[model samples]
Structure formats: C-alpha cells, structure tokens
Target: MALSQTGIRRWYLVHKWTSLICTAFLLLLCVTGLPLIFHHEIEELTGAHSSIEQVAGGGTASLDTMVEDAKRRAPAQVPGFLFWDSEKPLVAVVTASSLTDQQNIVIHYYDARSGAHVPAPPHDEGVMAFLLDLHKSLLMGLPGTLFLGLIGLIFAVAVVSGVVVYAPFMRKLAFGTVRKDRSPRVRSLDTHNMVGIVTLGWVMVVGLTGLILTMATPIALIWQIDELSEISAPYEGKPPPTRLASLDTAVAAARAAAPGGQKLSSVAWPGTMFSSKHHYMIAFSGETPLTERLIHPAFVDAETGRLTEIRDMPWYVKGLFLSVPLHFGDYGGMPLKIIWALLDIAAIVVLWTGLRLWFGRRRVPIEKRVEELRGGGVPEPAE
Candidate 1:
C-alpha cells in the first residue's frame, strides 16, 4: 500500500531525526572501520606481521613449548588465554595476566613450528589498537560501548524510515536517478536517496549486526550466568585449585571431548571470570563455513585434567560471534572486502548528501520541504 502524504511526513521526520542523531558516530565508524578492513595487510606491510613459511614436513609443534616460552617470558604473570591466528595457525598468541596489576596482561607470540618467540603484533598502545579501541568503545569503556550500540539502533531506525519514504519520493523517478541538472537542494536530495536505496540491504545488515556486536558484554554475561553456571554448578564457590593439572593435559582432554573437525580457538584458565574456579574453559570452532561461529565449550577439571562437560553455544552467543566478524567485513576474502569498502563509501556519500539537504532546508518553509519530498522541485538555500 502506498503511504499517504501525512504518512510520508511522519516517516520523513523519523528518517531525518534518526539519521541526524547517528550520522556523526556512523561517520567515525566508517572512517575507522575502513582501515580496519585492511588491518592485516597493513600489518604485513608495516612489519607488524610476517609471512609464515611452512615447514618441510608439515609437522605440528608442541603446544607445551609455546606455553612454556610464554611463561618464561613473563615469569611474574599467570597464564590466562592461549589462541592461534586462524589465518596463520603457525603463530600462537599466549596471554599472561599480571601478578601485581590485575589490569595488565602480557601477550607473547611464538612460532608454532619451531617454538621461537616471534614479535607480537601491535597492541594496546599502537595505532591500530587506538583505532580499534575507538571503534569498539570510543575510549569510554562500558558507557561508550553502550552509547555506540544506541547509535547503531538509531541507524537501524534511520534505515527503515528512509526505505519507507524512498518509495514515495521515487514514485516518479527512475531507479538510480540523480538529478544533476537541478537546484543544489534537489541534487543533494537525489544523491542522498539514490545512494541510500542502492546500498540499503548492505547498510541494514551491517548496521544491525554492528548493533548486536556492541551488546557483546551483555550476551557474554548471559552465557556465563546461564549455561556456564549450569556447567560449573558442581564447582561453585570452590576455592581455586592450588595444584592444578597440566594445561596440555586439560587441552588434550578437551580435544578428546570435542567433536572431530573442530579446532581449538582459545582457553580461559581456571579462576578467570569466564571460567570456573575449578575448571579450565576451552573453546573450539567448527571446521565448516557456517558452523564456525558456533563455539563448543569444553570444561576440564583444573586439578584432575578430566573433561567435565562439552556443550554447544546458545543462540545469543552464536549471534555475538557471527556479528563481530560480519560487522568488520573481514570474514570473506579480499574481493568481499573490496565490495564492502565500496558500499561503505556509498553509505558515506548518502550520509553527506542527507546532511546537505537537511542544512539546506533550514531557511525554506516546512510546506515546501514536504512538497520537495513529494516531487523533485529545487528549493533555494536560505543562507
């Protein structure tokens, strides 16, 4: 059903306000996130990362050496998380929590093939890290995180309202039509509407998924409070195990418990917030394209190295995992990244033109603005 003039006006207000509220944050996201898309490549070019050369025999290195070296490098620190780069499995990053400072953690990288210490990638203080933190939380911690999430929500509203009003505005214009030979206001309006409509689906998906990504903390809390609590119920309130079982043994037990074709993703040691005081929480990823986001957690007894429980991730947890990489547009190969970049640029243009039209309409009467939406007649700028 076609929208009435009153309906169009209502949606126009929705589109305008929502877009205005979130456009600034969205612009920052686009700028910071653009470099993030090519972060890996940038790392290689800047010597932050090195190309991994395969060993002669395709032999796997012992995880024990990597862990031992990591501990040796940070003797005062306790082991926390251990993970390998999916793209460069030959490199392992082991995190060690500081002994004196709870907030500080040391990250050590190792060549999985030879157990040699590799220079860790740029982290908290580096350029990429700065951009990453700004993109993630705007340097404001939880409040910043939640605020960006709100922006994402507003962007979603803007997308919906824009799409709704696009039909009425474009009723008389051809698809992808940009009125170049028109007033500045009309041209800006055409650019805004055209680019917005062209990138509608991509923008909506990215925006909504980005919104979900910002809720990661809450979703993780849910998992910890729900499924994780159930799994660790037997060990609740138990003191930290002083004489813990070997991490290698615990990992092996976890691997045995996990299904075939799943790869270990990361491990959270006992006493960590994400793990029970008496259990080492091990996470694994599926081998297939789709199931990769569905984490299968394996809980192993810290003292006995016994597999306690193995369970599939809940939907929200899966959604968080999926939303993260999807929002970054880094999951797919280079071609997909290029496409994402171009669509991102298109979205920026849409935002710019929208702002132009909005500012241009300040001096014009509201009636003329409504008529402008109904049919493209150039409106003069007030200044």
Candidate 2:
C-alpha cells in the first residue's frame, strides 16, 4: 500500500535524518568490518598465526606440562585461564599479576600436540587487531563501544524507514530501476535505494548483533553478581586453593562430565572472576555449527578435580555468545565469509550514494521529492 502524502513526508524525514546521522559511522563499520570478515584467513596470509603440525599416533601434549612452561616464562604472573584456539591446533595460557589485573597480562601459546612453545604474535601488535579494535570499539574502549551501539540502533531505524520510503519511491519505477538519463543526483538516489533494499536483511542482522555485543561488559558484570553468585554460594566461605590439582585432571574430569559432542573451550582457574575460590570453571563448546558458539560451563573442585556442577548459561549470555559468529560470519567457513564481505561492500556503496544524494546542491523541497516519487522520472533538477 502506498503511504499518504503526510505519511510519506514524515517517513522521508525520518529516513533522511536517521541515515544522515548514522551514515558516516555505518560506512566506517562496513569498511572495517569487511576485512574482519576474513580476519582468520588474513592472519594466515600474513603469517601472524602459527600452525601446529599433527603428530603421529594421534598423541597430544599434557596440559600440565604446557602450564608449567607458561609459568616458567612468566614466573611473576599467575595463570588465569587455559584456552583452546578454535581455528588452529594451538593452546593459549593467559597470565597476569592477578585475575583482575587489567594491565601486565601475558599470553603464551603452545603446540597442542607437542607442547612446543611458540612466540605467538601479540594481539595488540597486528594490523588485523587494530582494525578489529576500531571496528568493535573505535579504539576508545567501552565508551566508544556504547556509542557505536547507539549508532547501530539508529542505523536500524534508518533501514526500516528507508524501506517505508522505498515503497512509495518505487511505486512508478520498476524494481531495481535506475534512471541513467536523469541527473547524477537522481541516479545516485536510485542506486542508493536499490542497494539499500538489496542489503536490508544483512544490515539489520549485523547492526542488531553489534548492538548486542556492545553490552557485553555490563552483561558479564550482571552475570557475575547474579547467576555467578548463586552458583558459587556453596563455596562462599572457602579459601583459595593452596595446592591446585593437575590441569590434565581438571580437564579430564570436565570432559568426562560433559555431554556428547562437546569439547573443552577454556578453563578459568579457581579464584578468578569466572570461577569460585575453590573450583575451576571449565567451559565447553559443541561440535555442530550452531552450537559451537553457545558454551556451557562446569565447576570442578580445584584440589580434587571432581566435577561439582555443570550449567547452561542464561539466555542473555547465550545471546551474547551466539552473536559472535553470526556477526563475523565465521561459523560457516569461507563461503559465508565471502558472502558477508560482498554484502559489506554493497552496504558501503549504499551509504556513499545516500551521502551523495544528501549533499547535492540545489536542494529539492520535500513536496517536490514526493511529487517526483509519484510521477516517476520527474524532469532533472535545475543545476
């Protein structure tokens, strides 16, 4: 159904101002996010990542030995977590002066099969990491992240309003129609509408997911205060473990307790924010494409290595985890990444064309613009 004249003008203004407000940041996101869709592949091409060779007989290195190696390298630090690299045959040991230390953190990588230490590239040193930081938080950390989230919300509104305006704009023109013989501004407007319509689904998905991700910090803090508090209540008065059990023992116990088709993703040591003072938090991810991002955490006694309990994350945390792969388009491998990159490029084109239309000199009145939509191919605007 076509919008009434007043309705059309209102929606046109809504689309216009919303697009104008978010266009620049949206462009930045599309540009930075394009490369990030292929981040892993780019890392491989840049040789920034180390690939571990598969060992014969399918034997693997001991987790305990790897932790010892990490400790030897950073004697002053305490191990905070053991993480498995999803895309490679490697493991990472993260250490810091304490669990809550924001600075003075170190990461050590080892071959998952041989336990050979590798000088993995520093996360903050690479171009890809720089791009990622810019894309996620604009290099301003949490404040920047929340700002982008607001931008994303505005972008979503723009997308919806654009769709509403598009229907009336295209009432007389064929779908995907471009009036090349018209003025350059008209041509740009047509192309902008065309591309925006084509990439509507992708824009919404990426925008909403990014908005959700920006709330990660607050969500985590809430989890720590709410669910985490209740889960650790049984051991509330317990002291930090004086003698930690073997890493292998904790991992084995967690794995044995995990349901079928799940593998260990990470282990937060006892006394860390993610775990109780007397228990290790072992997180597991499923093998399937969709389930891989949704993780479950199990608590295990630090000294005895016995499984205490396993629980699925709350809905909000699961939403956070699910958005990661969907936002990056990494879960489906190369094919999906290519699709995401193409859509990102198209989004960039749409934003550019929209900006060109908005910045055109000879401003057409809202009434004239609406008349143009109704009449289809109104004579070119006076130069």
Candidate 3:
C-alpha cells in the first residue's frame, strides 16, 4: 500500500518535532555511555583497582575477621555492609554512612591467607567518581534521570515516525538510495531516512533499554513497597543477631538445597535487604544459558545456617534480571559492543540530519510560503 503525500508530510512533521526536542540530551547520553561501556577495562588499565587473593585449602575466612580488619583500617567508622565474592574468596566491607558524611568507605584489600590488609595503588577519585556520576544521573540525581528517560521515549517515537515516513519517501527510490542529484534538502532527507531505517532495530533496542534503566529506581521502589515488604513481613520486628553465623556455612547449605549441582555464587550479609535478617541470601547459578544468568536466592537461617527458602524469582524479577545484559550489550562480547557503538554513532547522524532538514524546510521564500499556506503550490525550501 502506498501512503498519500499528505500522510507522508504529517509523519515527517512528527519526526521533525520529536527529534528536535530530544537530540541534544540524547547526544549527551550517548557520549557519556560510550566510555562507561569499558569501565572495567579502564579500571584495570589504570592500575588503581585491587584484586583479593584466594586462600588455599578451600577454607574461607570468617566475616568477623574481615570486619575487624576493615575497622582497624578505618577506626572511626562502623561497618555498614559486607559483600563476598565466592569465586575469588574476596570480602569487601563497606564502612561509609552517607556521601556527605565525613566517614567514607575505604575499601581494604585483603589476602585471605593472613587476613592482612594489603596496600593498594593510589586511585584518582576525582576522575572515576565524576565519570560514574555522569553515567548514572548526570549529577542531577532522580530528576535528571527521569528527564533523560523522557528524551529516550521521544527518541523511540521519532524513530517509529521516521520509519513510517521512510516508506512513502522510498516508494520511488530503492533501498539504500540517496537522491544526491535532487535539491539539497531532498538529498539531506534521503540520507537521514536511509541511515535511520537501516539502524532501526539497534537504535530501538538501545533506546528501550535506556528507558528501562532509567526507571530502575522507581520500579525497584514499587517492588520493594508492594511485593518485597509483604514477603519480608513474616520476619519483621525480630532483632538481628549480635553474633553473625559463618558465611561459608550458609554457602554450603544453599548449594546443597539447589535442585541441580548449581554452585553458590555470592552472599549478601544481614542488615541489608539483599541479605535476610535471619539468614544469608546465597545466590546460585546453573550451567545452562537460561539458568546461568538466573539467580536463585536461597535464604539461609542466620542462627543455624539452614536453608529457609529456595524459591524462584517472579516473572517481572526475571525480566529485570535479563534486561541488564540486553541494555549493556554485554552478552555478545566486544565485537557486538563495537557494532552497538557504531549504531549509536549512526543514530546521532540521523538526529543531526533530521534537524537540518526540518530547519531547511522552515525557511521557504515568502511567495512559496504563501503558496503552501494556500495548498496550491510546491513547498519551497527555506533560504
């Protein structure tokens, strides 16, 4: 089916307004996102990041020992949280209360063997922290995040309208055709359509993923208030244990409860919701793709180190889990990420060219502008 010129013009108008409103913010987001794609690699290259040594005999150090070590390193601050990495047998005890507070989390690198705090190379806090802040919220916090998300939504709509208008423009020209011999405005429009249509799938995925990421805080808040609060109510008002149980014991119990031979991957401590008050939340991963990424959080009873619940995640939780990989392009390795980067750059070009076309069309000569208003003459390009 062919679209009438009137329909095409209507779609073009929609694409123009949508793209113009969102281009600047979208461009800023893309530029900041590019560096964050390889933050891990950059951290490694800078020699500022630290890695913990694994202790032999498969014997894990006590969380109490690590906590004591961390306290000794930062005597004034109390340990707020503990994070354990099973693969490396590493422990990270966070001591920071709040960003504005004088107490800051000084990460202590430890050798699991001697429980000694190892000295780490100096890091440029200014650069790394600035990059992280820019990537997450542009330093404006939730308001900035929601603002960018709205822009992403507009970008998605612009992409759709551009595609709708492309069909009408390309009805005469074949795919990949750029009408260079035509008027300058037509040439620019042709290039915009060609680039925009070809990169549709990639741009759409990126845009939607970005929207999901932006909504993460609000979504998590809703889930916590509506669903998680209810699930956690059963154990509420119960005072946390003064003496913590062995993390290693909880890990073993969690692995034993897993249906297959899924390994216990990580453990979140008490006082934090990731870890239950009565027990450590041990996450397990299996061998298959469907199972490997899916985390089965087995809640271990804090007092006896027994597995309490081995429930699977709900559908929405599962979707949120899978969204991270799709959003970051991390599932397909470096090559796919390169392609994603190229597509992102191409989207910028589409935005720029679309803006040029819209502004160019707006500058029509007085006579032609009058003709267009009267619906009796060809639309004139703006001078």
Candidate 4:
C-alpha cells in the first residue's frame, strides 16, 4: 500500500511538531522512570527503612489501639487513615494530618501487635522520595503533573504520526532493517526507524498509560462529583462528629452489612476527602484481578457505628486504579519486571535517535524532503 503525497506531508508535519514539543520531557520521563522500575530494590539495598523492624512474635494489634498510639506519637496531628502493609505483617502505617493545616500530613508507623511507634524507614525521607516526587510531579506538584500529562498527549500524537510515516518508510525495505553501510544521516535515520519499530508497542502502552496517570487528580475529582457528592448528599449539612465510634466496631458493622464476597479492607475516617465530614468511608476492594482495581465506598455514620450505604465503584475510577500497576509493571512477578526494564531501555534509545535524526536533518528544498519521505528514504548521495 502506498501513502498519497498529501497524506505524507500532513503526517510529517504532525510528527515533526509533536515530536519537537514532547521529546525533551519524554527523555526526562524515560531517564527518571528507569530508576522507578527498580525503586523498591534500590530502597531495600540502601536500607531506607531498615530502622523499622518487625516486632518479635509477629502478632497483630487492634486498629483502635494503634490510632490512639499514633496520636500520642504525633500529638498535634489528627488521624486520617489506617492501612495494612502486605510486606510487613507486624507494621501498620497511620497517616495523620495537622490539626490546623489540612495540607500537612505526617506518616507514622506502628508495630501492628504492640501498637508502639516504629521509626519510618530513612528512604521515606531521602533520595527515593525525591526521585518519586521528581518523576511524578517535577517537584512543582499538580501543575507539573498536568504539564507532563499534556506532554504525554503530544507524545501520543507523535507516536501515531510516526506510525503513519513508518508504514510508508518501510514499504520499500524489510521491517526493522537498518542500513549500516550508508552515511551518518542514513544510519541515524535507520537506527531511529528500527528502534522505533521494535519499541513501538511498548512506548504506546507506556505513553498512553503514563498519560492516564497524569490525569489521576482530575479523575478523582470527577469521581468525587459523581460518586462522593451523591453518596454523601444526605449528610451534606450535618456537622462532623466529635466522638466517632471505635474503628474496630465500625469495621465489624461494615463487614456485617457488606454484600456477599465484598470485604471491607481499608477505612477513611470522618473529616477526610475519602469520606464525608459526618461518616466513615469503608472501602471494599475485590479479590479478582479486575475488580480489585476499584474500591466500593461504604458509608457508615461516624456517631452510630452503623452502615448506611455501599455503592459500586464507577468504571472510570476503576480504570484509574487499574492503570497504576500496569503503568509500573507491578502485577506480574520478577519475569514481567525484567521485560518492562528491557522495553524501557529500548524506548530510551528510540527517543535519543529520533531526536538526533530530527535535529541533524539536512536543510534542503521542502519538495525534495517530502519526496524522500514519500519513499522509505533517500539515497545517501541524494542529501
């Protein structure tokens, strides 16, 4: 199949502009995201959280007891949520925010059995944290994330246009072939094309999924309007309770009222974004591969310790949740992680070669360039 002259020119324009706009950020994304693939490994090797040790005897403590213990450790903070760690059975993490400032939240670790404060790993305070922040938000927070998302959008366009160009480029040659004996310009072009083809599937998946990740905040906000507003509507005007029921009791009631096969695993206390100011938001994540991606929010009266409403999660919210593990290659075991690393390296090469080919292109008549583009490429002597 042959691409028309007009189509070739149009797609070239699209590829050129989009690639120019997103190449730099995409390079940064590749470089920083590389370490993130091995983030946990690096953290463990550096002993970032080594100071936090499992309590002897490996016993579990009551969530109610740990909440008070965490408050004693951070007296000025208000407990917001409690999460269980799968890797460390004897550890529970308590996220508490400032009494005066909502934005200031401190994370505290407690021995799950004894309810004693456990020092957080140094990694939480050091380089890994910095790397994660830099990769995700560029240290500029929401604006940075949104900006990266926009760049990702451009990257997607560039990928599509490049694909359009590739079909025409490969029409005259074997797929993935590189002309090593040709001039530097020819070789560079070939390298770019070959690497791009090899990694096309990966960059597409990573790029598209990466783009979805950048919209995480906006997606959550959408859920808030569609799910949160509707579920918490009845209690909209009610004041937050000063005395809430015990978390253990709340959990028990949530479980008792939950539908068959749905178990409440996490809870968001009153006065937090995950819950209404007047109710506890208990979350039930499914055990199945897909269902586990989204949380079904269960609302319970903070003062009464009784479940009021439990609604299924919206698809968009589930999509957001599912994207996380896939984007990071977290679902499968070590084999999949290795495959992710390999593809990541290939993507970096494609980015670099593409950048070089674009910038180093010879300055010639637009018609001549378009003609060269119309075919797979021009001869080395043509330039």
Candidate that would win on lDDT: 2
Candidate 2 lDDT over residue span 1-383, tens digit each: 86788888788889889989998888888898888888888777664254565443332689889999899999999999888877666788999999877446788988887788877676667889889889989998879999998998898889898888888778778888888887888889889888889888877888888999999988888888887787778876777779999888888888898999787799898877788778889999987877888889998989888998899999999999888887989888788899889888998999999888877734776567767665654546765
For candidate 4, write residues 141-224 as lDDT tens digits: 889999999998888999989888888777778877888887776787788888887878877888888889999889877876
Q: Write the number of the candidate with greater TM-score, choosing between 1 and 2.
A: 2
Q: What are the lDDT figures for the candidates, one per model?
A: 0.78, 0.83, 0.66, 0.75
lDDT, candidate 4, at 81? 74
List, residue by residue over 79-112, the lDDT tens digit for candidate 1: 7777766656454544545422324677777666
TM for every model, in the order presented, reads: 0.91, 0.92, 0.80, 0.90
Runs in model 1 lying further than 4 Å from the true structure: 55-60, 91-103, 376-383
Write out the backbone clash pairs for model 1. none
- After superposition, candidate 3 runs with Cα above 4 Å error: 1-9, 47-61, 76-91, 98-128, 182-184, 259-261, 273-277, 287-292, 359-361, 364-383
Predictions ranked by lDDT, top down? 2, 1, 4, 3
Can you list the residue pairs that collide in candidate 2?
none
Stretches > 4 Å off in candidate 2:
54-59, 102-104, 374-379
- TM for candidate 4 is 0.90
Q: lDDT, candidate 4, residue 67?
A: 82
Q: Top TM-score: which candidate number?
A: 2
Cα lDDT of model 3 by residue, 183-228, tens digit: 7875776678789888888788778877888887777566557645
